[model samples]
Target: MKTVKQGDSGEEIAILNNALTQAGYSVKEGMTFTPALRETVVAFQQQRGLEPDGIVGYHTWEALLLGGESEATELADEDFSRGALLLDCETAALRAVQEVESGSRHGFVAPGKPTILFEGHIFWAQLKKRGIDPVQYAAQNGDILYPQWEKGHYRGGLKEYDRLEKARAIDREAADASASWGMFQVMGFNFAACGEKSVASFVAAMQQSARSQLKLFVRFIHQGGMLFALQRKEWATFARLYNGPRYAENRYDVKLAKAYAKYAR
Candidate 1:
C-alpha cells in the first residue's frame, strides 16, 4: 500500500479500482477515494506482499506488474488459432442466450451451419487453452451449455429457431472480426497488411488484440489505480478517450462493461 509521489499519472489508482471491483469491492463511478477505499487499498497491498502504508507506491506497483505474468504465461502456451475459433463460437452461443434474455421476438437465427461447428471447435479449443473443461460446463447447464451437433448439423425444431437466434447473437458479440464481417463472420479488414486474408490470419490478429487487452488489464491492476478515472471503463469515459463519449456510451460502453464482467474476469 505504499503511495505514489506527486505528479504521477495515477495509473496505480486505476489499477486499484479494477482489482477492487473484480474482488467484489464496492466502488463509485468517479473512483473517488474515500476512507473505506483507502483502507481496502491498504489491505489489498498487504495481501499482495506489499507494504501496508495505505498508499499505492512503488512496491505495490512492482507486485501488480508481476502478478499477471503467470496468467500470461498460461495463455502463451495456447494454440492461438484454435483458441480464437473457440472464443468466437462461445461468443456466438452466449449471444444467443442473451438474445433470449432480451426477448427478441423473431426466432433465433442459427449461426451458419458450418460456422457453428467452426466456432464451437474454436471455443472448445480456447477453453482447453485456459484449462477449463468445456464438456463439464456444457453438461451442467442446458442454456449456458455448448450445443452438441452431429457433424456440425443442428437438428431443427420449433424451439430450436429461438435457440439458434440466441446462439447467433453470441457469435456476433464474441467475434473478433471487423464489424463489416457481420455476426460471427470474420473478414473485411486490412488483413493483407498483417500478412494474409485467411480466417487464420484474422484469428491471429484477434488473438493479438486479446493478448494486448489482457496485458493492459494486468498493468492497470498492478498500478492500483481506477480504470474509470482514466476514462477506461465507463462508456462515456471510454468514448471520450477513444471515440466520442456519446457513441461510446450509446454503442460500446455497456456491451464492453458486460463483456469485461462476463469474460475478462
Candidate 2:
C-alpha cells in the first residue's frame, strides 16, 4: 500500500493539523506553513517527547502518523516495538500533562496533572485513539461548551456556571452517544463493541475498533438512505436522525459530518 505524504491534500493537512492541535498547538484554517508554524510543530514534537529538532523526521513522523491507540499499546509491550518507534514513559507522561494543562485553559478538566506516569501516558494514548478532531469539530460548531470537571463540583462558581451553560448548549445540539473518550478520546461505543471495558483493555481492542469504525462508517455511507439524511447540510434534519428523528433538533449538531469528512479521506 502507498503511504500518505505531507502537503498531499486537505485531508492530509487536516490529519497533520489535528495531530498538531492534539499535541497542543494552534493552527488556523487555510494557514500555510511558515517559520512560526514550523516552530510550533517542533514545540509540539518536543512536548510529545519526540526529539526537539525542528524537522518532522522519523520519530516525529511516527508520532504524527501513528494512530493513538496503536502507539499506546505498541509502547506498552516493548520499549521500541517497530523500526524507529520508541516510547519513553517519562516523556509520554510529560506530554500528557502539557495537553491536560492546555485543555484546562479552554475550561476542560484534566484527569490529573500531566507527568511521566502510567496513568497520564495511558490517558494520552486513549485520547489519540478516539480519532475525533477536536479543532475542526470546535471550529464548525463552537467550543465544546462542556464542563471539564465532573458533575457536582462547583467550587469555581461563575466560571463553573458559564461552563455548565455552554455544555448544556452543546448537549442540546450533539449526540448523546459519541464514539470518543478520555484525553486521547477513543470512541466509547466503538471501544465497547470491540470488547474494550477499560483503558487497559484498549491495547487489545484498539486496532479492531479502528478497523471496525471505518467499516461501519463505510457501510453507513453505502446504505445511502438514513445515512444520507443524517449527512445533510441542514443541522435540524441531521441532528434529528443523529440520535432520533424526533428527539428535538436542539440536542444535536450536524457539523460533525463535515469534521469527520476531513479525516475520513
Every candidate's lDDT: 0.38, 0.35
CA shift at 22, candidate 2, in angstroms? 2.6
Cα lDDT of candidate 1 equals 0.38
Q: Per-residue lDDT tens digits of candidate 2, residues 1-265?
A: 0123334344434545666776567875443444665677778766778766666553465556443442221122122121112121122222232233222212112222111111111222333445633343344333222223122323342343343344334342122123232223223333333334543344233233322222222222223233344333444554454334543532333334333344335
Model 2, residue 223: displacement in angstroms? 39
Query: At residue 204, what lDDT does model 1 achieve?
Result: 39
- The 10 consecutive residues of candidate 1 with the worst lDDT sum are 108-117
Q: Model 1 segments beyond 4 Å from truth?
A: 1-12, 65-265
Candidate 1 displacement at residue 102 in angstroms: 46
Cα displacement (angstroms), candidate 2, residue 78, comes to 22
